[model samples]
Target: MSSPVILEDLQEAFPGWCIWRSSAGRLWATRNGRRLSQYEIDHGLCQTIDADDVAQLAEQLREQEAAERAL
Candidate 1:
């Protein structure tokens, strides 16, 4: 199960989006009725994170999206 705090951070970082974990434990974030990011958590990797990590992920996503838009 994913941490509620992390989910909350995602919500704050991307308002009006749906953030949830699938039954298989993959984390997903969607915005404007579209999928934004999907983090696979079943790889025995990071299953949880601190607030700073959440902030970093959000920033990274923003940068990626900006770069994509620039292309």
Candidate 2:
């Protein structure tokens, strides 16, 4: 998979942004469905991903796909 797809998959695997109704009604990542503050989401996404880690994941996925294709 490509970098974008890898990122998408990672998001899907972990907690993801969703429609939330709370003090603030909007997409949120909190378990309570409360709209997460900008700081919350920013820090959360950062904790979930590192730039180097994402690049490594993308490279691994690409190599796997290439191997599959070769078969």
Candidate 3:
């Protein structure tokens, strides 16, 4: 219902990631540590992940996690 509450829920849903919603309503997520490598980028991982909503954002994050594990 509030910004801080929503942020806390997002953090719980996606631990260790930095999550935020933009002024226009797009949801963004990025890892807390080092950036993705060149090989990871070439293989489709992103430096900053964004989506129209939470579900899509979760999907992208899951893919990113899987890709990183594969590397």
lDDT of each: 0.48, 0.38, 0.78
> Which has the better lDDT: candidate 2, or candidate 3?
3
- Candidate 2 residue runs with Cα over 4 Å from true position: 9-52
**Ten contiguous residues minimizing lDDT sum, candidate 2:** 43-52
Q: Write the per-residue lDDT of candidate 2 for residues 1-71, one digit (tens) a residue.
A: 23444445644533332212235422222232445456654543221222345445445344433543554
RMSD of each: 9.9, 13.5, 4.7
Candidate with best lDDT = 3
Every model's TM-score? 0.42, 0.32, 0.77
Q: Over the stretch 44-64, how does candidate 3's per-residue lDDT look in tens digits?
A: 878888988877777777788
lDDT ranking from best candidate downward: 3, 1, 2
What value of lDDT does candidate 1 attain over all alpha carbons?
0.48
How high a TM-score does candidate 1 get?
0.42
Clashing pairs in 1: none
lDDT string, candidate 1, 1-71, tens digits: 23234757767665645556667655655444543333332322222322234445555445444544554
